[model samples]
Target: MALNLNDLQIFVQAVDSGGFAAAARRLGMPKSTISKRVAALEADLETRLLHRTSRSFMLTDPGRDFYEHALAALIEAEAAESAVRQRHAEPSGIVRITASVPAAQFFLSDHLPSLAVAYPKLTLQLHATDRFVDLVQEGFDIAVRNHFAPLPDSELLQRQVSIDEVILVAAPSYLEKHGFPADPRDLKNHAGLLVSQTAKAWRLHHVDQGTISVSPHCRFIADETLVLLRAAASGLGIACLPETGCKAAMEHGQIVRVLPGWTAGTVATSILTTHRRGQLPGVRAVVEFLAKGFQAERAATGNVLEPLRETTEARS
Candidate 1:
């Protein structure tokens, strides 16, 4: 007997959705029909794939391996169908994207309207949180991340879309009271609002002076970059903030860049996806749209932290 693709797809869905009943609900099929199809799939393979009891259904060892390969095959099959359909019709599908809250707010939110206008048929689901999500397991089609170092090893493919310079910043009132740092070393004497995820020591680099590392006396420590930026703006302390995040505040004179000649570090912002999903038209469209938007924003904000060669007087 030939193995049925529908049976394989049903089996994979059952495993993914956690139970036969759930899969049936998702597929809009009766529970008995779904169970019978999966059983037929196992019979065709001459092995029991799932160990099912009255209360539980568990994958046998062979089932575990089969589920992995079957899931990939189903994804490829769907992509193949999508590609053919897209060749004849418009790109129309849900693309789930995950990113940190600030990235979602500052980088993605404003550009979504343009995407909606361009791809009227397409739908987007955005998951905004600071926590790192497992793209495949979480059913996310793409992820946007900011990293100062190389991303950890993973099967997911990454494409760098933008570079963000991290610079020292402080509110005008705070700088007025605490004084501006003449050199990177002077930062130690100031109260710092630190992002706890950063290195224990702040590593500031200069074009001619090399690198200087300092552990600041932190007034507050937070895991979110946006929180640190807020702390600095509230005059709680100095913060090493991304140039993009602090741009508007600086323009309004709410915050001022200190030590323009030095930078905390450069972080690369990238989009990540599985090799198979990245090839889908819907996913590809979103990625290109985001890449271009970020590039345009960077161009418009040219030379965010260019050194001011001469020390400018602090805000009054």
Candidate 2:
């Protein structure tokens, strides 16, 4: 038999309020409606739940038993509702995130300390890899991707975080020994610390809005950014790296910019997710935090080359 939940609620309220009249006052309904609902509930259960008379109102033994269980169920239901509402208000849970090694190291890692302080209840699990991750299949909450070209269409919602400029850098000693490139084509003669050995071409964009593509001679090859950074700093060859990754080394004079007026390219860094909006509070908090942090990082790193630029100009 299908139990009438409304009648069940009225029956419990009538017991607690001491009478049908008082329950009607509390529930803002007429006493006759309150009495009828409890009667309907008794009929549905095929049990006499109340002894009603002109002066006295009382409960049957079965009515007392049912009242206890019904009241407990009602309380549990209310608590569940409150808990769900709290999730929307607070960011508290594990948010699994994925990104490339360099992105996780240089960009994403920088924001974690502050993110922890801001959202104490949020826990982050980072998966750092260069391979593409299927967010849905892999059960990831967020993914930061670096795109060298326009991002391909996908089921994931993509939000552009920042544009990272790719530039050529090498140790000062390497540049001194091999000599700096005076023009874009001159890069062909220079040894390159490349991510891949497959005769890669570096497409350079100049300050004067000019563009050129040159295939550098690969001297050292590594798919990892940190490896390439170390090779360049050790005076192995000129390495093309994101400006954000090169910022500290340039400031420390470990490496200097090559062909100062040109850049290899600009990469778009984006945040990918399963939903465009209305994400879990923890996930939304993380996304917004990273987006703001990357923008600030890009702005701060923009001038890291100024000192190097001046030093290089003096030598030329």
Candidate 3:
């Protein structure tokens, strides 16, 4: 019996992805359909393709040989399809992305919906989290992150799209109650809403002068930046926040800048990917847009670029 091409394709996905269920997920097909297709492939070939175990799939010798052959054929088939698509397709494909909460709200939320409007054919899937996202395993096309430095690994190709200033800000009322310290040194006495994860020690930089390292004796630790921003705005305490996260409140007079001259460690937000040259049209478009988008907004807030190059290099 001759094997159907589609069945063979399903078999390849099953083998590559390690199971029928995983293949179904990757192919966006039903698990039952994937299982049935693989079974049909086995019957057509007159041999059992996989030796099943409790938690793993093992290929028989013939199955292994067939897998190699079928995988090559699948690659050729994909290339052919891609070539045809390249000629006729618009920028229409699933673009899976990941981003931090602050970056997502401040940077992407408005832009992404607008992007969908511009490219009606394109489908965008966004995954937002404060914790690290593994691009390969999570199947993410792009990751927007707060980059005080380079990506943890060199495998990810990253571009500096936005510069988010880490600044000391507090509610005007809070300052009134606690009394504004004449300098950065007095911050130790105030109720500091410290970001427990990202900022451990504060690096404050003066425009004309230099960097001053300050570590506040915090009364409370905010697990997330939003919590930190809200608390600071509500006059609970002072916080070191990225300018984008606080820009809206800052502009509306909800929160006021605490230390005008002192700058905390400003992080450079980056778009990360595995593609070295950034070949994907969607990825390229977003990256270019972010690069220009954030840079232009710098004038409104004095978020000047301070290259965390030393940090990135050290990590790499």
Candidate 4:
């Protein structure tokens, strides 16, 4: 294989920018040069790095696996240059981060932009997905997840970002038409709108360790929280949704919580990352900033909604 420093750099740039032409623009290089370099690198490895098609460009399985390391190498190299230029100043380099969909909408959408405005020299690469990805293996300096636990690998670490709240609600109008259930079992008569791609019985927990299962067989299930929230807001039926996802509708009083006595667990939001190599200027900077930003966000959230508002049922 003929993979070299330049080839790796080209691959890293393409992944970060999401396309060859875009990477070329970011690096201020000719598109043809970028393509030639990437093609050569793929040829050297005798494996396709990317699955390029007319309307889209995506990393192949090998490409996705190789991307993480390439990203780390490029970041370290840039950090070196930035350090030499600064002399005695702080570290400055590109920091790439990833987050789940809800986390991105509720937290990053605002915070990342503010951070960019504050640090003009800092280049931010943020990607949003609901699926979890390996932070170290994927070359991302930071990955925010809603349900994360400590990884056994000592090289990696995680810190709590926030405690998300999950609440059950239905449109006020719908409740009026179909009398609200006084007990959890009473919901059998009403149509339920569950969230997910497949049908699963909804579960609820009581403070007394007693659990109740509710199945809205005539339920409408959506894959996205946003879709679920809108459906519930329109009085589709009852749904157990995350507080972070339904905060807006609740604020407007379009949907009201039912069986406030029950509780649901949202797991916990966390930032997954590797501890650091001697001096990973870029990754370290992003990690520090993220820790501080999430701490502030968690503090603000506590005031907006009580953390232990209710117990939640875990969905499969």
Q: Estimate each model's TM-score.
A: 0.66, 0.69, 0.64, 0.61
Q: Write down the lDDT that model 4 would get.
A: 0.72
For residues 1-316, what per-residue lDDT tens digits would candidate 4 score against the true structure?
Answer: 4357787887788888988889999999998899998988888788898988768899889988889878888788888888676544554677778888877877788788877776677788999998757666778877777762433434446565566656678999999998787877887777878765565666778777588887764668786777878898998888878766676688899999887767555556666666553136656566566667766655755623333221112110
TM-score sort, best first: 2, 1, 3, 4
Instruction: Give the total clashing residue pairs for model 1.
Output: 0
All models: lDDT?
Answer: 0.82, 0.82, 0.76, 0.72
Candidate 1 worst ten-residue window by lDDT: 307-316
The 10-residue segment of model 3 with minimum total lDDT is: 307-316
Candidate 1, 40-111: lDDT as tens digits: 788779889998998888999999999988888888989899878865666679999998787887888888
Tell me how far candidate 3 lies from the true structure as C-alpha RMSD in angstroms: 14.1
Give stretches of model 1 more than 4 Å off: 1-89, 197-200, 303-316
- All predictions: root-mean-square deviation over Cα? 14.8, 11.7, 14.1, 18.4
- Residue 24 lDDT in candidate 3: 91
